[model samples]
Target: MNEEKNKGGMMSVIAALGANVLVAISKFIGFAISGSAAMLNESIHSIVDCGNEILLLVGNKQAAAKVSDKHPFGQARAKYFYSLVVAMMLFFAGGALGVMEATEKLFHPEHNVENTWLVMGILVFGLIVETVSLRVAIKEIKALNKDGLSLYRFLRESRHSEILIIFAEDSCAVLGLLIALGGTLLSHFTNNPF
Candidate 1:
């Protein structure tokens, strides 16, 4: 793989990885202090995002391997394999855990969040970090898209999975943070953490 050609993808992945790591640590701390299930879910989500970014980086490295006699076309599909694995991780690790937690919360109806301020603070920080990462991914994607297509079209037709995955993960993180913020505020006001 040509570094010059893939610089944007690499930068996007690095930015997302950094963002997820920070967000995950902060969220875990917040969850520990507040006991917010939402915070826990966000922490898991960030960890999954971090893991996905690392897997994608590995995919990049694998794809960069020299063509061998056994495989003449090179390992370009390594990215796709890693992308599939990332998808499974997101679905099983992130989505399934969130769903299970939410269901348990529904049944238990406990005041999980003891410290609203800290949880809210963590959520806001996560939002900011994820948004910045998302912006980086978008900028890199836009640079790669030379056809002047609409954002939706570009996203749909994009071939670069690194930037695409970063964009998606960051977008989900921002949305999750927003939802968590709203839920936290509601719980604080209503005295209901369920």
Candidate 2:
């Protein structure tokens, strides 16, 4: 049962990782072609998500390490440590950079969104990818949620950190993609990149 639970959690994470990689590449290409700041922001966000997923995997491996004389208590706490690190990265790296970029753009705004259609298309594609990733996470979590706990309570009490993080990341990614699409469309229509 433990193995099955772990495997289910891992499936969500792996699915999210795959989706993030695909969106990151597409966002980068879209940014290159369209010069859209929103696309650039999303590309950077996706890259961070990919890195966070990798760290979660590393943390899982560390948690599974056999006990030794050097530390008989085991390394299970490493998962929490990595989870905290991922949260910090989301704030400091991704969120901060986005804020700084937006401030800069506000001061010296670009004239218009170039290749608007292409940029919007890429964002829509990213939305689909993130939504799929989120659905995978939700499905896995629901299977494990045998106690019929509310999502909020489950997130608070669940010991499954990896899948929870995947769920959160994908949830945020979906929202971000929608916002980017809206901003891109507004910019294109208004002929302003602010």
lDDT of 1: 0.81
Residue-level lDDT of model 1, residues 17-106, one tens digit each, is: 999899999989988877767678668777877889999999988887889998799887797799789878877877778788788878
TM-score of each model, in listed order? 0.88, 0.90
Q: Show the lowest summed lDDT stretch of 10 residues, model 2.
A: 1-10
Summarize candidate 2's per-residue lDDT along 69-171 as a digit string, tens digits.
Answer: 9879988778778878988887788778878877987898767556878877887888998899899999988998999999989888888888778888889
The regions of model 1 sitting more than 4 angstroms off are: 1-5, 35-41
- Model 1 C-alpha RMSD vs. true structure (Å) is 2.2
Model 2: clashing residue pairs?
none
> Candidate 2 local accuracy as lDDT?
0.82
Which candidate achieves the best TM-score against the true structure? 2
